[model samples]
Target: MTLFKVAQLARTAAARGSRSYSSGMFTNAGYEASREHARGAVETWKKISLFVALPSVAIFSYVATKDELAHIHHLEHDPPKFVGYPYLHVRKRKFPYGDGEHTPFWNPLTNPDPEE
Candidate 1:
C-alpha cells in the first residue's frame, strides 16, 4: 500500500525474476521495512533541505545592485536633461530612468547605474 512496501515488493519480485511487481503484491514489508524507509527518507530530506538553503541564501544575499534593474534607474533618468546631442530633442524629453528605463538614452543619466 505504502511506497516503501511497494518498493520492497518490487525488489523482491525483480530478484525472483518474476514477470510482474504486482505478482508479489501480497509480500508487503510487514511494517518494519516500511517504517525504516519512511524514517530514513524524512531524516535525509531534512538534512538535505537545510544544507541546500544555506549556500543558496548566502550566495543570493550578496548580489550586487549592478545585477538588479531597480537601483540603476534612480541615478540617470530621475531628472531629464536637455542637450544638443540631436537625440532626446524638445517635447521628446522624458524622465527615462527610474520607471524601468534602461535604454541608452536613459542609462547615462540614471543614478547609481547597475553596471557601475
Candidate 2:
C-alpha cells in the first residue's frame, strides 16, 4: 500500500478506537451510578426494616408474655413467707472458752477445743 494510504488508515482506526473507548468509559460510569443507587436503596431498606421490626418484635413479645412478666414482678415484690418446721429447732450454744469464768486449761497434749 502507499505510505499516505497507510497513514490515513491508521488515523481512522485510531479515531474509531478512541470513540469506542470513550463510549465504553461512559457505559462503565453509568453502571457504577446504577450500582451506587442500588446500594443506597438496600441500605435505606435495611434501616427501615430495623426500625419497623425491632419495635414490632418488642411489642409482640411484651404482649405475649405479659402475664408471665406480671407474675415475675409479683414474685419479686412479695416473695413467699418461709415457715420453719416444728421439729427443727435451732439452739444457741455457749462456747466453753468464750467467757472469763470458763478459762481454757494449758494442756498441750490433747486438742480439747472442738474447732481445733
The best candidate in terms of lDDT: 2
Sequence-dependent TM-score of model 2: 0.33
Per-candidate TM-scores read 0.34, 0.33
- Per-residue CA lDDT of model 1 for 2-59, tens digit only, reads 9999999999988887654463324565566767888999999998888998778777
Candidate 2, residues 3-116: lDDT per residue as tens digits? Answer: 999999999999998877555435878889888999999999999889998889999998979977887777667655545555532336644664533335633232222223
List lDDT for all candidates, in order: 0.61, 0.68
For model 2, the superposed segments whose C-alpha errors exceed 4 Å read 1-26, 67-116
Residue 18's C-alpha lDDT in candidate 2?
A: 86
